[model samples]
Target: MKKILIQQLFITTLMLGLSHNALAEDKKPATDSTPRQSTMIILDGSNSMWGQLQGINKIVTARESLKTLLENAHGNINFGLLTYGNKKKSCNDFTLVSKPEDYDKKKMLRNIRKMNPRGRSPIADALKQAAKNLPAENAHILLVSDGEESCGGDPCAVAKELRQSNPGLQIDVIGFRDEKEAQLECIAENGNGAFVVADNTERLKTLLDGVQAKARTIVNVTGTPVDGNLPGSIEVSIKSTHTGGTPSRANFSIYRPDGSNIASFTSRIQVKEYLEPGEYRVKAQWKGQSYTNKVIVQSGKTSTLRFDASQSGMLRLSSLNSNKEAVKANYSVYLANGDFISRHVHQDNVDLRIPADEYRIKADFDGTIQEKNISIEPNVDNNHVFRFE
Candidate 1:
């Protein structure tokens, strides 16, 4: 009996030990979050977005979506609003309905209600302007667009350029009954964001409001840490080589990880800055150019973070007659989102860092032949090649 009792006790102990071990194996560890990111909402007031559906105009549905987005947003998340309906020519046309601040249900809803659809879909211009509303902190842009550019501008190209300029910007695009829905997908993928489509206004409202809530929450920034450390400050070395024409004189800023101004390097081909620890945003001129990389500073450790910028991508235009490659082809590239990457072109390759997703590439060879709907993938450095005739 004593032996049996002892054996039973041993069995129980073993089982408990195994259970603990299994629990340890199955348990997932928690990660550290770096505070929060900022979000900007650009609601499309284009006429197409105003189409009627289910006894309501799409613009009305968009308003409801804005309300939902507002209601769902976290109390701390900041958001700004810009409307484009009545005016499309001037950056002043799209008025700042609101700057990124706390959630204001009444204000947001009212702004939506006040939006009158009357202007063209100047998406690229709107996006470029919207960038001003957002701080250089970890930020995202949720742009809702319907139809392609009635104004005949490339929103997808704008998104691609912005993304290449800053790999950190998250651009989420929503298409409401867009015949050109495919293009917006390029914008989202390249911008490190998602592209969603809504068949109706309710869905659009639900998605936007819900997504806005997520955007309003706290955001932590992440990136490659510098290998080494310097006690006081770190040196940032940048080399920008423009493949084509001479780069225009430009000025931009970089914010440290702590959201502090670490260094202000003049916009030039080569420059350097002394920075402290934290994430930083290096803003270049509006000429639509920039790239990202890192260098580390440690008390006792010396490390270097290497970043290379070249216009490369997974999407290529093939079947180029040897003649096409022989001479410079003036071309512009467009991503899926209603954005324009290149309005003007060169005969050879233009280095645009596209997103890591499937895309539709459009090429205007010699400004006469328009080749549209070319599929592309991200991680484009060497995975793809272009041959255009």
Candidate 2:
């Protein structure tokens, strides 16, 4: 009887741990392939960019990186440049440096090399003008900054509004130094992009390359009630032939009959919910990211939904030496009960695919033993890397 009780408890914990993800079985969103996307580069010409790093000025690095990016972004990839250095102090000081144009390698390199970093960081104004500046309806903004707004502009507010105005618009931000990461992250999310840190000027090239790669993804969503009734939750199945890398956010636009924006959120690798929907548009936003698809929302039967990166956080572990190397030995992971969650023999990584929760992780490998309690959250990655002899 004691053993039965323990088994029941383990089953209960496992189910409860994954309750959040179970909602995907209820409602499913349609999937559709998307078209090619364009990009807009928002250059932060603040004096900080001109500062020296590793005996190399960042602006110079930015220029070189721009040349490399422009040359390799493929012919379909167009470009645009918005510089804060070229702005004025008056209310009408906002200007458009270069509208969205063909990726002219020569012109882009020249502009970057000629960039004279000056003035305060006017992020808000630059974003506002970016919207007015870019020609394509579906485009992304690459915000390169090292500090907060010196010109007292609310960049996040502007980016959010711009997203509402432009359905597929996104903003990918890279901070050069340890400034306000949280604030800038919001700006990135508002634009439906990702925020990253550039520890050095050299990373500018890699960062932009990643952003460019992420921009090509395009996912389309269409929604309709199930059996003429709306369910408590919606299950969206994502089927795509992706080559490599990950798409940041699932673009969603709740619209009225007249096709005006109502509510929008970037999906976090989970089936989205809270639907009393009429008509909606869900598009994937990333720089070079392209997909040919439609997001169909069905209201009736629960359908399975898949996430590129499961908001569900989990970890795979293996016993390792002090050198942080996996050990070639017998190992097994178990729940509080004796039920085997996973086991290994000389394996480097073990699958710990689970929903967000805290766990007492134990390991026995190579005749050495260790145990650890681990936690996995929904939106953020869990912090747990273990090694054992």
Scored by TM-score, the top model is 2
lDDT, model 2, position 289 = 22
Weakest ten-residue segment in model 1 by summed lDDT: 224-233
TM-score to true structure, per model: 0.45, 0.49
User: In candidate 1, how many Å is residue 78 off?
Assistant: 0.5
Q: Give stretches of model 2 more than 4 Å off.
A: 1-36, 86-95, 200-207, 211-389
Write model 1 residue lDDT over 1-389, tens digit each, in one string: 99999999999999999999889876633233544556678888766666865656877766766666667554435667877765554434677777775435577777778787766777778888777777776667888777666556777788878877776677877666546776666566456554556554433443454343333332312332222222212223333344334333344455654545533434333222323333445444323443333345332222333223333244443335446444445555554553344444564545555434334455445454545555443344532333454
RMSD to truth, every model: 18.5, 25.6
